[model samples]
Target: MPVIVLEASDFTSPLFLVRTWEVLSGCITFSLVASLEPPNPLSDLHSTFRIFCMFVWCFFFTLTLLIHILSIIQFHSLIPVSWKNLTMTTAVLGALMGLSASVVFAWMVMDHGGRLTHTVAAAVASCITFLAYSSETYVLRTQAHEQRGYMGSNPGLLKILQLWGGCNMIPLVMEVVHSQGSASGLPSKVLSWQLWVSTALYGVCVLMSLVTVVVILGDLAGRCFLPFDKCLAAFSMIGVLLYMVATVICFTKILQLKELGNRAPTGVTELIIMETVVASITLLAYTVDLAFSIKLLCDRSHA
Candidate 1:
């Protein structure tokens, strides 16, 4: 007779593997799209942005692959757990990958508004990656802190996650509403202003995410070195609050200004639907994570 053994940790290992693989898969898929486009189709600046985006995606692909390999070994107990720095390092790398992608997306949008399929899709995908990475990094930090008993970890962070999730969700909803309202053709003035506003709001979202990364890093090592995590967290929430307000204003204005001259083109309708799907997935990920974090926080408080 043989005896089988399992640890509590084993239950969650598969989730990490799946999450990491999703990031890698997304990177590869988008990189292929960005790379296959004809060179110099736009201008020198546009060409350079595409090249940079391709490189960034490939970098994340390789990095996540390495992380996945190590994680599998770690989960099986084939490797020692003494490497406390590994997850933190990976988290920082993930953040950097996200930031790089965000910059490239912003550049593309500036060069050619989000009307372009490549630009819009890449922008949406990059934002999803940023949220995914940020959430995972937070989880890693929370696990480390809980193990060491160095911090009462989850509640504060969970608050941030919940807020972040809700706030980020508003813009995506607004985007979908705006898309539907403009199912007809868009006037040039309306299109131009919409593009600029969307770009600017994206910049704010990026900054909010970056601050969350900073807060996590500041606390992860059990150091109060930054001493300003709370302040930054407040600002992050404020940023999202403003985003929510802006989204409402934008949505209303889009409806008011939309032209009814022609029905939406099939391609345009399909693209908007695809983007909405992507946004929905991201929103669901954040919401689920937020709920899980809340449960963990409650369990810890009771314990």
Candidate 2:
């Protein structure tokens, strides 16, 4: 049995207000989109993308409400996971997903022809929802500093970005895999190998990141016999090296394919270019994480 202990302060807090706005705006955005008629054949992609946006909204809404309810009931300690980490993770993911949804939904709505007024209104609401989620993330960060949660730290946040970047590469990798047999040549083979290697490197990095996150969240960092800080520094360094290789491979191979003109499948060049950009950003994040990890290790040694 769970006891219900409502905290008035929780409801009155700035975080609560932002979350309320998120829920309201999310509802508005989805409702508007849902009310519109099904899109025409040409706009099917846009319609499907809008559905993704709606799913994002619904996801955050449900999670936010659940967190609120949990907090009100004072059940934080009963949960298996760290409440603070969970909150911070949700806030960060919500902000990223909200921003992506807002931009994508707005672009889809504006680029095509139909129900302009309603879609535009929905886009505006989506933007507001993004802002709300961003605000929540900011607030959570400030609070996290005081709470001293792992996910609130610099390295922890970088891990989330790294995960996102790795996930972004998946679509491009899948595209390449799907069109594997469509082309046959030395250039094609080389390009495929490059993409595969890059994907593999990042896949390893993402796996390490997930392991690190679990260690931290499970409160096993201190209990583990391993030299966690040193291992993290080593992992970060290796990740940086791997990302550097991946970045070079991606940019060089992609450029070569572009120059070859028709060696690569249609639209793949563009996807690879986008993936390269994400990889570049992810590489920078890995570098920063390496620095932070080293600093933490040094500080620990001195202490």
Candidate 3:
């Protein structure tokens, strides 16, 4: 008797690596968005919630990577043969990723004082998300008639995603254009105001996400929801909530220091410093995600 290695094609034989990676990349994004946490290089610098969020970020980050692996391993040689299927899958993933990315940037959209960069990013992303969601809705509806309205899709959250996406940049965009008070200081002028706005927005998004989650959980045992789709929605939501909380903390600190002047921490200072570190890490993550998604999709043809 000879031992044989199992190939992914035995099950869903049409799928292949690169195509699969694309789908996985978008799917993983949901968890990654929910898992963002500010990293602390200063041993003493700390926020309990922030720490917890970081842990979440790491966890989701891992999950995202793991899904990439699954996509690679499972579809290593099947996806390319069916270009039509592959294209459809890529579109679905893009739409999902766009929707999830909007959640990822919710904090940016909610920033008070209103940075135009954030506003623009949010707005552009939201349009992307809505377009993707609408397309997804059409696809889903075509496949399953029972999924009318998410069983508890909070209109409020949907509204926020839309409203926020419509305008992402306010102060930042203005500063870039006007150069008014764009000077470098321990605490940037725009930072505090942004913190306040982001914090408040996160607070609201959290509430909306929480309500939506409860509804999802309640319906878990019901007949309508698909396990994978429901799970995707829930996980992506976790990322949105984390951004909200972290952003709120940034806002609160700024407001507290508003009374202190130059003596203590300011919101702008904190975000600038914090984001400075996280930006590199997140960029790496995004690159990895893109490589996994696109490469996997492309690899399907090689097999």
lDDT leader: 2
Q: Candidate 1: where are CA atoms >4 Å away?
A: 1-59, 66-194, 218-229, 253-303
Q: Model 1, clash count? A: 0
lDDT of 1 at 110: 63
lDDT of 2 at 147: 77
Which rank order by TM-score, best down to worst?
2, 1, 3
> lDDT per residue, candidate 3, 1-303, as tens digits?
233444556444333333343344434433443333333122222233223323423433353344345444554244323222222333343343344344424433343333444344434534443354445334433543233333212332232232232122222222222221333342554656654664454344345434433444344334445543343344344434444454454455446556666854323454433432332332233234334434544575586
Candidate 1 TM-score to native: 0.41
Q: Which of 1 and 3 is ahead in TM-score?
A: 1
Question: Across residues 63-157, which tens digit of lDDT does each residue of candidate 1 receive?
Answer: 66666665555542443333333444444445545655675456546654345566556666776666666665666665646442212244334
User: Against the hidden reference, what TM-scores do the models get?
Assistant: 0.41, 0.77, 0.29
RMSD of each: 10.9, 4.2, 16.9
Candidate 3: 10-residue stretch with minimal lDDT: 165-174
Candidate 2, which segments miss by more than 4 Å at Cα? 27-58, 107-122, 175-199, 257-270
